[model samples]
Target: MKPISWCSAVIKVERRAHAVHTLRFPAHLPTSSESRLPSVTSDNEIVQNIIAQAFSAIINLKHLFLLGQNSQPASIKLSTLASCTFSLCSFAGQVSGDLGIQEQLDFLLKHPTIEYWVPTEPFLRSVNSFPTNILPNLRQTVLVRPSLMKALGGRPIESLMILFIDITHSRAVEYTHGSLGPDWSTIDIISNLSRAAPNLKILTLGSLIKDDSVITAENQQSLVDAVARFCHLKILVLNTYMCALQKHTDEDPDPENPLEHSVAWEGRSPAQARQVATQFMTACPSLRRLSFPDTGPSPTNSLTYILSGTKAKLDGFYIIDNSGWWLR
Candidate 1:
């Protein structure tokens, strides 16, 4: 009998703690110790078979992590895995192109039990649009870049509970003087999530920049309005230099100089933060926690004001002295 090749042997499944299970499938099988590549068709077939076998064997698996260098298997059903993490280059590099990737992604997202999904790949430029009804049962998602937002195309996921978006890469386009491509802004992201995931309970935003020159009272109001849509939010974390501010134009410039507008010129003023806290607390009656990394001195004051004025009771709030703590 012929032995299974390295490509086939690489298919492995390991059970981890808390009922979580991981399945690792190699994208390509090595023919020799030096250098080699396996037949795309053969490798894909083996991967599909292995995944099916693993799924059948691991009935109680909760968390599934897929790790591959450059590619992923095509259209493998995973309706049972509660959480899935994909760390692949593009969908399936050589085997599945743009169209194939989209089709495969659509199939994978159809899983009914998937609650948390983290696709570590940046959005593929070839794929222009995403399916409308993707991940109907998804509850939490961690978007690493803005391209992923474009890939999702603002698809409404009514079941979403928590969302963490990091847009550190797009800062050049959003803050610096540059052509703002299809990149999304904090406001855009919040608005899209609000409309799509109305039941969102926790939202954490990173790398939010507020250029006083560009952001005015009206712009800040827009942000406030967007946040009001999260009627069920309980925990809010803003890892930003500034909260959306009230728009102030040159003609009717802010009474105080922009430099002296607040303790932290680039950050939200106590008054402004208090206003936002009040509005958010009013809109989201369940809000119990608030956190801001860049809040200047008296971070708790604004939130405290809200607690005193409104009926909202905050379990706790934090004004992170160091920015690195929240990112960790």
Candidate 2:
């Protein structure tokens, strides 16, 4: 929490707790350390102490955004998070485990009047499968995480977007796929969706990567399996990167070189993309339309693929056609 913003916001609303409805943590929550990293126990206590005190002054709060995944407090419910004893406890710093998605869910469950929930990494990382029946009024606002999807078992959701990226992970493009780039993180989430939101109408999923070749049509049968999990998934959008074919040699050019062989890669053709799209359409008979990442010979607007008979046509519709609805 930035002290300047906290001081200003508190000064403005210190006497008017009712005036504060939204509680959001910024992109970076600073601490006593120069690195500003999380997991610093003493530093985190200061943050937790400050946070625990605020809820008393914020009884009418609606939106509280926390997006960390450190050590979470065992008793993470509203009571412990806002109490004075929790503030002074030796283990007080462990409130919501570094930007807990679980904490946000607890907040959502407690406050039903909250209309819009912001996106955070923990929103997708939550595991406790809280039931939907607890608050029937929240039917439309359910934010789904992979493991948390089980909580929605036998429930329904209209729209959803699941995203995965090696953009900043150990498997990023800079890591060069480490080993054949077989680590697609979207699998388990897809499987959860299949059994969880059986009536999901519109869906979008992406495994954004630098080298699209890492997930070409050749090794995508598992993805097809995951997609088949949804009982009634209709309009679907797939965001992916298409790779151009590349070949490398294992030539040890230098005779005195200690190292032996070399390594390189592969790609996905437009034909391959079409094959995979058709696979998805076949996997989900309920699917009326689907969009795939474009394979590029030209950098033109790569369009969506919709079911036509047993195959998919590539240039008519677009997934973002309803982009305006996202603002609502």
Candidate 3:
């Protein structure tokens, strides 16, 4: 028999009145403590195997957070995770089927403990497969790509308490594809999230709307509806372009097209602007803080309508766009 040193990482999992802790480490026997250095472990396979070993031991734990998994599927092997009391869990790259997505979901149904989840782009595609009952405790989520939205599609997400979506990372070059980025469709995503995570309190959307031509009126309306569904939203942040008011006079590819006007301004119309303001005001009646960039063709009108509608309800508001332009 050979002696091997192990780095023990302990995790705590708690249920109603019970608590369980699991200590996990890598499978391969380490020669010495020096072998655990950042340079010694170069392959991700070693890291994930370590996770598997750690999670395999505990029968029932509470609040699981897989902050670091190198390359193996972490979502499927939830026999151990399901038994634990997980209020917050995060997966780095992808959660494969082998991880027992359904079993984990069933466990969540019987014992709903997860409150916050952050799964990367690769895991988003299969996220919808989780049990619906687990949604009750899911309060916050961070979406990374379009696949994530698809995974959550048709699921009741209204039960959430807070959500943060980032679509600016999309690599799509076409405006059509770009506008349909993860954050764009997030309006509908939030709608579903609202149903699943009903206590949703905070929402944030950030993208480079100035460079993309995909954000239009129809998509805007859908997003507005999602916001309208948030009965408990207190903080809302929306980031878009306000460069519509600035276009080169010499640049005239077409002058008589109405679609050009809408396209020119990132899909801004008098009616849509008014509707956005109205919907936001009506959706979050208890709103305390609102922040958004003022850009595009009708920035002034958009700001006016949003402020006017939320004036009675808003506790505080901050305008972060067009700061330098206004100074000149």
Candidate 4:
């Protein structure tokens, strides 16, 4: 591979295309089971040195995107890149061992010009706690995991404009029986965003879990109230399953009164779902775009109400129901 001499660079080790004008370095470490394990120590040092050289080569870089899998470079390797002046820095893919979440945040903080800090994929093992100090120049953020919500708590991010909370990967396990779902405290963290990120223009909350372990009605209402606080929000994407109460079934039941034998499901009805959506639209008067999940024959009366009553001149209203039946 020839040395890169461009002012803007996008280096991807993986096949997938992520960010443009991004600088990605390979951080793969050989395991003991692999034949190259004997030379792993030397190989890592070489990779680090190459990364350092590459960082030095980019003289006038403005935006940087780092992509790696399974492992991340040590603090020293990261420090090399931090030395450069960049306005945006993004770390994508699974990061474990040496460079944990705190260290990654530290690296971002070191760069004084960084206005956007995006960490994609399963970066943190868990999003329980976060640094207290605010990133002075940070204006945009993408918290792809629900756990990352902890990062926004308490601190005032007055400049933050775009925020994305994608809990699809983390919410999968919560759907199983006996699982209580994600920490309810995360909701408080989000609610605080109204004051913290008062200027937030866009907010997206998506869940990829196919099962029925949906957010409780109480929490959903709380989320609506919290989001309503973002007075400047223009776009909102809410992809979640409404809680449905499971019915009790037995060998025999009265045909005359089936309602007598029915039991409450664990999830909420379509009406409750509409109520939550309506609250968000009503709260954020500046809202122009609204997106909801396409969950089969779910009622959309709430959306209709928003369109009829609100005078925000909506840019678009979308339903992302991937199920082929919706298309038919």
Candidate 5:
């Protein structure tokens, strides 16, 4: 069965599709393993119309996604869906591509019930195309680009996750001043959030790093003061350090003290990470749980560093179980 004909078969179920709560449009078809995010594809005008017709027939959509691919410019039609979404709560517009989102701004502008938006990173936010009124009710977001905070300055946003993934960390920098790749070094995320979403509670900042995530004893004080920017930040998760997935030491166990817990997981220690977490709690007393999640996509357990009362500081600290992210 071809895609267009397949869509026709799906539309026949319009009577039953009223219960369908989510819809997605993927422009590039994905195979079985691309199940991370399923969406509508194909830019053919007929396909676009068919998808819109399918969406229009469904009456109970809560989440709608329109994804764009880097291979071509984005060309998803949205004008017809205005009457389709009486219950639409979340909408992801033009995720993953940089260009061709100018056409979708109309749909976002007219809809105030869309509480969440996940735009393509770096470029979309850098261009400032999303007028401030486009996302009036936006409360939570997965932000790969924080420059958008300027336009989103004073919303009632409650949560934000600044997730940065750098697989090949060997690129040179030139000040072409574009979003080809995001440089978090120069951007002060906390300052941006303090200005944009002052009421934010849960914030997750995940980055991929090559070095150990340990800070020295001398500079720990300064790091603590820097994190006191937000008032209601309860859960703060910083995941950048990667370590071995085992707790076995290489050399002899210090011969003198056999039961000492000085051994390292892989080659890095979570002592500094914990100390810094403590400092964050000290500076910002509202923080109840601080997590250092694993560098993952793992099948086992991940990591956490919440404020615990027991003597299990190193219980889940140094044990690298390659699993879940910090409360994401």
Candidate 6:
């Protein structure tokens, strides 16, 4: 069937399709399945056949959910589903390859008919490698890596209303390794993402930051600069280091007093962390809600801290503690 003709039929009988093409796996599959391996392949084949045949006949899919639990390929080439969600509900490890994921994004971008997308891991992992034109029609996307932000580069998907990134330890490592290749650094990760998804309204990042010491003055400036650039950001969630207390070493510049946290900070006491926070609060005038948990101390020199310069558009602050709640 031609794509157009199939579309019309889909429009004619769209209401009945919520259950037609759905695939659900049974709760229990034998763990000791040495003899029934063919069943796994047969199951995937059945799913693919159902989707292919259904698309050809109905021409329009209202909702589609493709989930994989057996590490098998969950392939769907339908270019224009009204709503779709793919959950690799239980993928034990990494999944790879570009062809299957690329096709889905291509279809999702080309057709304005699609309204939502929730792709699973391994498939979602390939977003960095996809071309810029994919997801042009996407309005809401739930992604698992920063590389997915590359797909949003150049404002192609400015229509995006929501974006969720699941940057767990393994996921963060995959993004860093995949996009940065070998020349990877925490600063590189922050800089590239800031530029790639400038218009993002809501953003979340989760990482297993191993060392707070990695956040030096230079990198900290990079982070602050990046935040300053994105004026439209309304919500930012990051799971990273708060601060690092320096430890003394053998070869001290001053033998009388080895480098302590205070010495390492160039005479700036740990209390200055609160001063830095105050500077941050002052920088973003349009900021509505600011929250940083235990990142450092509350801003010191509160009297000198100017919220008046905030353009009066500020609502409240979400300090690492219960400041926001207590004020309410």
**Cα RMSD for candidates in order:** 10.0, 12.8, 11.7, 10.7, 7.7, 12.1
- Model 6 Cα lDDT, one tens digit per residue, 165-244: 23222222323334544344445655676688666555444333344424555466666666666666655544444442
* Tens-digit lDDT track of model 3 for 1-328: 1211121232222231233332222223332254554543443445445444445444444444332233333333445344333333322123444544555456446545554455544334345444445545454556543334344444434222122232224232222232234344445445665564455566655443334422464465566566677677776665543332232343432233333344434533433333344456666675555544446522432233324434422222244442111011
- Cα displacement (angstroms), candidate 3, residue 40, comes to 12
lDDT of 4 by residue, 1-328 (tens): 3222221232333212232245543334333344343576765565456556556555445565433432333123455465554444433333334556666678656664555565544343344555555455555665434434445544333333222222223222322211123443334545755665667776654453433335465566666677777878876665554442122223233244332233421232434333445566777677656655424323231122233355322222344432211011
Ranking by TM-score: 5, 4, 6, 1, 2, 3
Clashes of each: 7, 6, 44, 10, 7, 2
TM per prediction:
0.50, 0.48, 0.46, 0.56, 0.67, 0.52
TM-score of 2: 0.48
Runs of candidate 6 exceeding 4 Å displacement: 1-15, 18-47, 50-65, 68-102, 113-133, 139-148, 156-176, 179-187, 208-219, 244-278, 291-328
Candidate 5 lDDT by residue in tens digits, 117-208: 76554344345635777778888777555556666776678877765431112131222222323343322455556667788898876542
lDDT by residue (tens digit), candidate 2, 145-238: 3444456455445666644432113132221222112443555446656676777777776443434324444546777787787767788776
Weakest 10 consecutive residues, lDDT, candidate 3? 1-10
Tens-place lDDT per residue, model 1, 55-126, is 454444455444333433323333322233432111211222233455556555545456565543333323
| Residue 53, model 4, lDDT | 54
Q: List the residue pairs that clash in candidate 6.
A: 6-59, 293-320
Model 3: lDDT of residue 88: 34
Which 10 successive residues of model 5 have the least lDDT summed? 166-175
Shift in Å, residue 298, candidate 4: 12
Q: What is the lDDT, from 0 to 100, of the residue 70 in candidate 2?
A: 39
Which candidate ranks first by TM-score, i.e. highest?
Answer: 5
- Residue range with the least summed lDDT across 10 consecutive positions in model 6: 319-328
